[model samples]
Target: MKFEVTILGSNSALPTTKRFPTAQVLNVLERFFLIDCGEGTQIQMKRFRLPMSRINHVLISHMHGDHIFGLIGLLSTFALQGRKSDLHIYGHSKLEKLIRFQLELLETKLDYEIFYHTIFGTNIQTLFEDDSLIVQSFPLKHGAMPCAGFLFKEKERLRTLKSDMLSFYNIPIKNRHGIKQGDDFICDDGEVIPNDKLTKDAPKVRSYAFCTDTAYLPKIVPIIAGVDLLYHEATFLKTEEKRAKKTYHSTAEQAGKIAAEAKVKKLLIGHFSARFDDLKEHLEEAKNIFPNTALAEDGKIFSVELDRD
Candidate 1:
């Protein structure tokens, strides 16, 4: 399965010429999971040629305007496109009421089922799951009423059979499926071939973490530990540590420290404050702690490939 993430918006509370707000899309195989739809998110998807129909699951971290202002527009576009696929939304309870109010006031009935799952207190709860992937949410220390960070992990696949062993034993195609599923097959000659001997190990699972608008909190270390890629909000520099605490935000260095402590493979820091024009210092600060740290820029795609089984 193919795994990738695209940054739609990376700005903080306001929109700049280069960056918007917080929004991203994680493409797991053919399906897309939209995370935190901010202002101009639909426009961003159009810019990247992403199939709007492919996105049926939307995960909102909080009720902030920058994180949800684009939802109404996106839903309206879905309606205009004559979509009939069911859409599942996971967020806080208030978001459900908010979306319902908008749809009621506009008198626009959706063409498909809209399932809403409200996540109350976060304690590494599984918000949504399926055969391909599982998504979990954890509480964040942001000043909002309630905020969360999401973790996406691809489901484990069955092991593959060895070509030499398959033909050597004259294994039928029907039996091949059983062998791939870790079942031992008996040959006509009565030769015993163990599943472990005939098949290689399964591919390592890949996971991505999305965290934003939070202060430096180590409580999430276990929830986001050892992620393949982590996108953490770094709205300020170390010099503004005081301001970061006051505003319930994190510095680039703090974000890097968390990434390093969590042992994540890579880290993408964003949510830049309006004070700085150049982000070289921010990158330098993060890299000082986590060597694989990168800056999150709008309209940029980060690709990740999983190992073969």
Candidate 2:
């Protein structure tokens, strides 16, 4: 299965000529999940060639304009394209009101149903789950705004049957499911065939965490520990630590600290402030603490895999 995260926008607060605000798309086994929809997110998506119709679930970190301003435009475009699948949006209570009011004022109706799941309070909980994957939401410290971060995890996969061994053992086709489920096969002579001889272990489950628009909070470390990939907001540099604290944002160093504390396999830092024209300092600062850190650039894609460490 293909699991990757594509950065659509990676700036913070304001959009510059080269960078847009915050938005990302996570593709797990071809299913796309969008995170944050800042202004110009649609344009970024188009530039990256990510099909809007493939994104069925949209997760919002906060109500800040830099995080959610492009939602209306994206939804409107989906409606214009005659999309009929129900779209699921998970966010705070105000998001529903904001979207519904905008559509009502424009007298525009959507062909698809919009299902809103309001995440209330500040508790870490499972937001969605299915046979293949699961998504969880945890509260983030983003000043007065009730913000959240999402964790996407792949479920345990079924073991694979060794075709050559199965043929050697003369196992019937009806017993394939039992072998995959780790059950021993009983032959006509009542001899037991070991499950390990017929099957191989499945790939390890992979997880990705999205932590943006939050301050340096250590409490989140345990919740996201040992993830395969972590995308944290580095809205400022270490030199602007005081300003970052005041605005409840994280510096590159702070983001690196979180990733190191959580023991994640790789760290992706983004949500850069527009004051700086380059990201050399951000990359250097983060790498000083976490050597596996990388800067999140627009249209960049990161693949999720089992951590060798």
Candidate 3:
């Protein structure tokens, strides 16, 4: 039961000597979510031994080159590797045309089908879901046409019957499912066994939110409130707050403000400006408000285990 996030790239627009661009890997259950593929994202995946085939879903925050430049390369590699599974991509409406243009220019035909869901509104809507997890997107103010932040939540878990309780009560093996589902078993002799005495409550659901390339907007607080983990772009330190606003990006302090207001459990900030050689200022600025903040670095992996209590 591991739910984790791996940072592949953390640089904002330009690639620095220490960082790449924007890319993150979200591992929920057994599914892989590639969020905002930037340059060299495929290489990072290979370095980390992440299975490209298993990654069928990609969520692009915006159409900026730093966020989506690596998509073409990744798709090309998938084709080269002879992938045959249908892939689904969620992003703004222009993504369909943008990707189609590249494919058309290259005259490349994918062996797999590519499904695109273009997000155009500012509502919190479920983009896709499976038995284990659900993914939703909400609009962010990135000054582009429309950029979105994504949320991934694990599905509700079922209770597991304690083996000791079952063995102590001499419960039949065939009735385990019923017990786990809170159903009491009635014996042939008319004996009743309460469900609470057999099983505990299910594990709490875990959630993660990705907010990038957005200005200091507190309106998104409600949408991502109480998320287990939050990844927000912190392109500048507090000293450069004006610059961040001019660029429609958030300062480290601003990112922390949003996380604190939203009451997120943990905050990871990335997309640092190229001017800063050291990231201590960014971390300190965020920690001043949100003590749980961590500066995002390339190749850094953060694993999140949900608290059952």
Best of the candidates, TM-score:
2
lDDT of 3 by residue, 68-170 (tens): 9999999999999999998999998888899999999999879999999987657887899888798998988877558899999888877878778898888
Please write out the lDDT profile of model 2 over residues 74-130, one tens digit for every residue. 999999999999999999999999999999999888999999999874898788899
For candidate 3, the TM-score is 0.95
Over 4 Å off, model 1: none
Q: What is the clash tally of candidate 1? A: 0
Off by over 4 Å in 2: 306-309
Number of the top candidate by lDDT?
Answer: 2
Off by over 4 Å in 3: 170-174
Alpha-carbon RMSD to native, per candidate:
1.6, 1.5, 1.6
Q: Candidate 1 has which clashing residue pairs, if any?
A: none
Question: What shift in Å separates residue 29 of candidate 1 from its native position after superposition?
Answer: 1.0
lDDT leaderboard ranking: 2, 1, 3
TM-score of predicted structure 2 = 0.97
User: What is the C-alpha local distance difference test score of candidate 2?
Assistant: 0.93
- Candidate 2 weakest lDDT stretch, 10 residues: 300-309
